[model samples]
Target: MDRAQRLAYNQPTWLDTVAAWLLALLWILPLAYAVWTAFHPTEYSTRFTLLAPLTLDNFSRAWEAAPFARYFLNTALLVAMILAVQLVLATLAAYAFARYEFRGKNVAFALVLVQLMIMPDILLVENYKTMSQLGLVDTLVAIGLPYFASAFAIFLLRQTFLGIPKELDEAARVEGATAMQTLWRVYVPLARPVYTAFALVSVSFHWNNFLWPLIVTNSVKARPLTVGLQVFSSVDQGVDWSIITAATLMTSAPLLIGFLLFQRQFVQSFMRAGIK
Candidate 1:
């Protein structure tokens, strides 16, 4: 009960620990390399030396070469606009799906779920054509168009709403609360965790999205951070690895920082949503 039990309980779980470390290393290694390159001198970036000269030269050079400030502003605007619309639409749709019983409701919801299975990126050609017809091509709105109606968001929120007791809704109604009022005052507050989780996931995905933005935005004025990184990478003058890595860091740092800052909220949201 003493020595043997202590040994059994305290013994290192070598296999599990090793596997976890390997998984962490798989992710951390690339980010570490990127940071190293970002800080390393251009001459030392690709060099095998353990102690190559580190400096701010790459970051400064990358910043000077591109209008990164503009890119950040545009990306922020685009992400905000998309999230705003998605939140409204997803909430309403989720609420309706969770509470209402109408003809073809199941069919319509099924179709919406189908969009989740079919990658939104695959529909780019049709979406681009629609954007062209709407005269929204090459705009920030165009870059956000394809993601405005998120099936996954709708589904997640609907599930969250369903997990709430019907009696809560009935109680709200008994107090003469309208459906909209009940949704705002009751459901939304209760589902805050799911909303936070979804927002984190959505922001991360849209922040890193490159292909749709690349296709829709033709100018730096509308290009998001991802497009900005690509444009810098594709410059024909020459390939500068150090500068490229620096640019990548600048492009991704905001999302990384946001994740770190909101990690507790993000993790709690996902956990609560999962339990629901």
Candidate 2:
């Protein structure tokens, strides 16, 4: 090609560059606004002035307005407990579906998958009644019980297991290994990326989950960050945007810090799971 043609081909389109910047700003603007509002004093949040003096007063006031420390602890406990149960349940379920040839397997798997189509919040009434019947209402265990077996987690892990070569199982069999042994030694290690990806997603989901926890947990002993933030937000006659934003930031900080600290691993796990 001639130099003129090559020069034209190499030139970047201004529209494309402008679009990229605009898209970046679109995604970043909300986070920027939250941080800005969180740092400002209560009186300045609704103001458009960028140069407004910042203060720690909003965060201090937000902290004092609610039992945020207890909320954080509860949320962390709930997430950890649910994830622990889910990991074991999903692993066993996926192993059965992947390795066993039981009658009606497909039908059973289909029923599990049907749970995914039904929004979890839709079952709240029935679940609440069940909890009441079991006398487990207003407990952290009740908050975590409904999610013990995750359809999505089972499906993800099953797909990961199916991706492994059948020869691995055969090889383990030649060495006198049982199905469970092979699964533990060969499949679990290979599926670590999927587990990590699912763990991160699950933790984020349960951490932010509100309605179920709100309905089940009546006291500070089991109430989570979302419910706590609501209490803080509604304390004033008119909601103070600055204090609410500060509370929100505080509530989200742990997950935000977790993602930041494990960002590379998180990205790699998701990418690996996607590729599989």
Count backbone overlaps in model 1: 0
lDDT of 2 by residue, 184-207 (tens): 899999999999999998999999
Candidate 1, run of 10 with poorest lDDT: 1-10
**Which regions of candidate 2 deviate over 4 angstroms?**
1-20, 48-51
State the local distance difference test value for candidate 2.
0.89
Clashes of 2: 0
Model 1 bad stretches (over 4 Å): 1-13, 48-51
Candidate 1 per-residue C-alpha lDDT over 173-214 given as tens digits, one digit per residue, 9 for 90 to 100: 999999999999999999888888888878888888988998
Q: Measured by C-alpha RMSD in angstroms, how accurate is candidate 1?
A: 3.4
Q: Tell me, what's the RMSD of every candidate?
A: 3.4, 3.9
Indicate which candidate wins on lDDT. Answer: 2
Could you give me the TM-score of model 2 versus the true structure? 0.89
